[model samples]
Target chain A: MVIRPIVSGFPPNMHKVPVFADHLMLAQRFEHPFSQELGLTGFGLVTCLEGEAQFMINDQRLLLNTSSFAVINRGSRLMINVDETPARPVLLFFRSILADVVAAEIFHRQSGHDKELSYAELKDYRLTEYVHYTHASVKEVLEQAIQLSQSCASFQALKTDALLRSLLQSLGQENYQAIAVSARLPVVKQSTRVDLYKRLSHTKSWMDEHLTEDISLEDYADMALMNPAHFLRNFKTAFGITPHQYMMERRLELAKKLLQNTRQPVQEISEQIGFDVLSSFSYQFKKQEGLSPSQFRKQVTTD
Target chain B: MEESQWSKFKLRVNLNASVEEAYRCWATPAGLEEWFLRDASFKDAAGNAKDKNTLLQEGDTYQWLWYGYPDSVMEKGTVLKANGKDEFVFTFSLGCPVTISIYKEAGETIVQLVESDLPTDQGTMLQHFVGDSKGWIFYLANLKSILEGGLDLRNKKEELVDVITA
Candidate 1:
């Protein structure tokens, strides 16, 4: 009957209804960055809308920028941190019962009922920890689910049931993509390939947080706990792009956003994205965007 | 008019576009056509038709038609308030007032819609309260998709009937 916030509360006294369709889907928007060690009760999709945030889950520090999101598993302790610049994050937490039901449905449909025997217990939501981009359908459906979380709406529980199913289904697809993406590594064992891919992904996330710096390949290899040659080859194989190429892509993406949004000069924006020389930044920007940095700014402002 | 408990509801969507773009989507006749209506025409107080690109004023009366529906199914209403930017209020179904608020929130532009005041009889309650709420949710989602991703989720195929899309 009562709703309590996750920060500075005894515990989140969220809905615990019995039915899966009536499952509790609660959303909490954090106005400012927070720092606390709290245990999660269900899957929490943490999205950084404005600023950067650090989520420590299962001893891994995952940095979420505006372009990325992270999923926190149930029963995992999370430590959220934000610096002087505040990060606005929205968390969508759903009861495990909802995920379990969706998982059962997915498995039952995948394995038709003509089987001779059936397992009494269905699979639970044991999604592995990972960070993903906002382009995922999970993010889209999460936004839809958030709209129904309003207090004044009726049949919210009924409405959210469909969103939950789609969200879980999207997560299932994401997990499948994760495995498929890891298959890019030429390792003989699939488990080794997946584990190596996760490490490489973690390294890439670290570079995302520190985009403005000139990080060395040795440092990335060290962080990923692999030899530099091995890391470079596997990173290229798993992601289909070398680390440097991926870094440049992300840096330019950030540069375009800065150029369009802020009044910063071209040189300043160029340096902000880690281009030591303004000329090279402009060259790269023009190559990727088909327009010069100043030209892009002018086009945006005029439009 | 007796105000019933279930006559009004509010919904909002965070758009990837700017506040100016969000306002344009709901304020002008041509703007409404971009994401919402198939055709929109606004007239001044003197019954003169306003320009399609003209920003709607507070006293303007408007007629809007949808894409899938017939031209006979026009919605006639008057603009209640228009600040030329960021906010718009207009009369909607059954003369109910719909308020639109657009502002920057957490680095994204948000379009907040509140539709209120309706005849709370059984039929009107179901049509406006439940039906309109559900309808606005889809429209707002469609608006976000159109603005953010340039993908219109509307069911533009006239051959298809009984769809819940735009």
Candidate 2:
């Protein structure tokens, strides 16, 4: 274990947050893959902030990219594999008492009341190992923890506990959101529903960002690590729209924006929005907007 | 007299960006508008206004407004230390100084803020220390998000009142 200096340079209050909050944080840049059995006694947060890594839990392999975070419950058999790519993954181990406090806060905030909640009822698959797209706040703190662990000058512990506390709270909220999204999945079992939704949502966000590029269904399925058929079926089931239809809607939105905002030619705009042929772009645009691209541009300009 | 109320706090965040870029985010008015404010203007000691993209200098006074605020709602303060690199200091309120330091630690750029000399009265403690710290938390997150290629989280509409990003 390599211990770095972080505490000496920081003020007393600045250094005590994660330590006093009771989270043991570890952040390192892996030069090579280290495959080791992760003996987690408490809840663990594994984040691949940069590059990619893979984890094996319950005999299932889960890949974590920059867009995803993995959570492991206590006593879970976990193995992490870092690829040859340089990856900086931060690991945080925290006690159950803190997790309970965070879980309680989630319920309190959700109900909009300061009501007492049962721990057993609250404790569920959030404790199990699964990778999902992170909540923004959780991702923010993970960035902090990565630096805190890296900068511990001469700590009693790399305690970013205050930061970790907020992180656990965010993590609980993420689970709640996952549960909400799971309700949309057509799968029978609750856990399966949530898992399928996570995988599909993860792919959908990435796909949305790359909508202007020409990407095949095979590539999209490969990104989700599912066969194209299963990916297509579950994607529609979870999101209520087929990938093609969703892409078309999003592309039309982009097309309209470009047409209204820029003087770029319609043919150029069609190619910019990923249409291979101008005729199909015009057809889709006219169907969606009730006017051709040039007509839509003229109407906007006049109005 | 013993200090009975909390006057100030320190916030530290690690951004996945360069020290130079993080410094630019705080030291330049254009960069400030990119993440933190609807408008930010700085004037030199002689009351000469600086260019929008110019780096602030020590003793330069600044006016800042937020995204959801009208131009009438603004903060007027003075820059106390501007190193032109990774260190900046400005008066957040008349008696309060907020110093920002940017550096690299643990393979990430760390931006640290120390807000000191706050008004120690109960109302100010609850409002300035409590309320203002909440504002910093969101802006810091916004700064990180913008620099890290995530969505710009600021609520830009003037009518979007009471949002954390605003």
Candidate 3:
């Protein structure tokens, strides 16, 4: 399939806008399976308007149909595959500053106060990958954004900003609802609930910072000021995943980045992410990603 | 075909509130008065007066007044449909159909307003389409501000010009 670049440059007069850069591309026709390693410079939202697409982030695989979309953060390695014919997917990339604004709004709404958080700090708050099912309203808003980007309308920049804010807000609410549902409990005191959320956030941040180290459940539990068992349960309930699962996902994510961006050997990359043995790391990577480390690297690098 | 192509004004906003909370703001009289109108009341299909605090249901008739508007100036409409907490369809000034949809996205509530079935006459179209579009934009912004920041940016004074420079 021939990849058609629709809009590759930033809006010339829109420098003052929060979006630093934006690009839109369309695949003409999918004759053969295509894959590309996306070293995204900022936050990206990719929607499949017509056919199917596949995205691999860390060891997680997401399939995008007409109703589904993916949001990927910067500094992450993404492998995208298009196998279906007549696939027309649009990808929009925006600066991390825009993401930080959304993150700050969410934090303020949930925590009741705005804390100064840098782009890096906000990036750490993102899920490994966000895959959402779009309703008609969201689809219309996204379609409008694409239309505005393609148009030369004088207010296109402002219009696009408004649409993006709307999109981000929707995505934020979806994330919050997911957490609320997973951590289903009766209404508790606001102060206690906020404290619990803070502790959980700290635990996740701690995990991100120590992805390369040998960490224990006791350490995470202590960070949350709870017993090991209780911490494990609450963490799972709040995040919809156990502490071990979260750590493994983070390690794999780091390993994928090193493999794609650097010339590090697979064994060394494994060790860098806290894997002790080469064979075990390779086995686990292959089991989760459906390809060995070298093979995955070659697949991305050659394409 | 030409009439079917009448201009439609649509606006979307993501609020830092839940779907239920956002829906309430538009579905109930008290909720609407909080940020939208000055005085709002409704009656059910059976002509029974519905409490301002309760959610409006399908076939409910609404009488709405803006703060700066005179006592004689009031807008009347019917709640054509209210689909749970997700969608509410009602009639606005000049009988234009206004559809409000609320859905949870990411962790935020997204509220979308689409006003359609407008007059096709060129003069009427310009008056309602352009004028109401601008008004809706301000009202929507006020809705977001009031819900998220607890600040009402609406002009409650009668003498103040409501011109919003975008």
Best by lDDT: 2
Q: Which TM-score values does chain B get in all models?
A: 0.94, 0.94, 0.91
* lDDT over C-alpha atoms for residue B161 of model 3: 29
True interface contacts reproduced by each model, as a fraction?
0.00, 0.00, 0.00
CAPRI docking class of candidate 3: incorrect
Whole-model Cα lDDT per candidate? 0.69, 0.70, 0.67
**A60: Cα error in model 2, Å:** 2.9
Could you give candidate 3's per-residue lDDT for residues A1-303 as a string of tens digits?
012342333343432322343233343335556676554334566667778888775454777767766666555456678877667656655545556666676666666433433334444424424455423555666665555444433223334454565566565555454345433433377445544665665567567767788989999899778899888877877777999989888788778888889999897898889989999889888888999999989988998
Candidate with the greatest TM-score versus the true structure: 2
lDDT of 1 by residue, A9-87 (tens): 4343432212211234333446665576555445656766567778787677878767777766566666667653655
Give stretches of model 1 more than 4 Å off.
A1-69, A72-128, A131-150, A153-173, A296-303, B1-166
Q: Give candidate 3 regions above 4 Å deviation.
A: A1-19, A22-32, A111-122, A128-130, A152-154, A175-303, B1-166
User: Candidate 2 — which residues are off by over 4 angstroms?
Assistant: A1-24, A41-45, A49-51, A65-76, A83-85, A92-174, A184-195, A202-206, A213-233, A252-269, A282-303, B1-166
The weakest ten consecutive residues by lDDT in model 2 chain B span B66-75
DockQ for candidate 3, please give it: 0.02
Q: Per-residue lDDT of B1-166 in model 1, one digit per residue for the tens?
A: 3456777888989988989988988988988987888889999999999999999999999977776544434567899999988999999765689999999889999899998886576645653577678778878888898898988877775455345673
> On a 0 to 1 TM-score scale, where does candidate 1 land against the true structure?
0.45
Chain A TM-score (model 1):
0.59
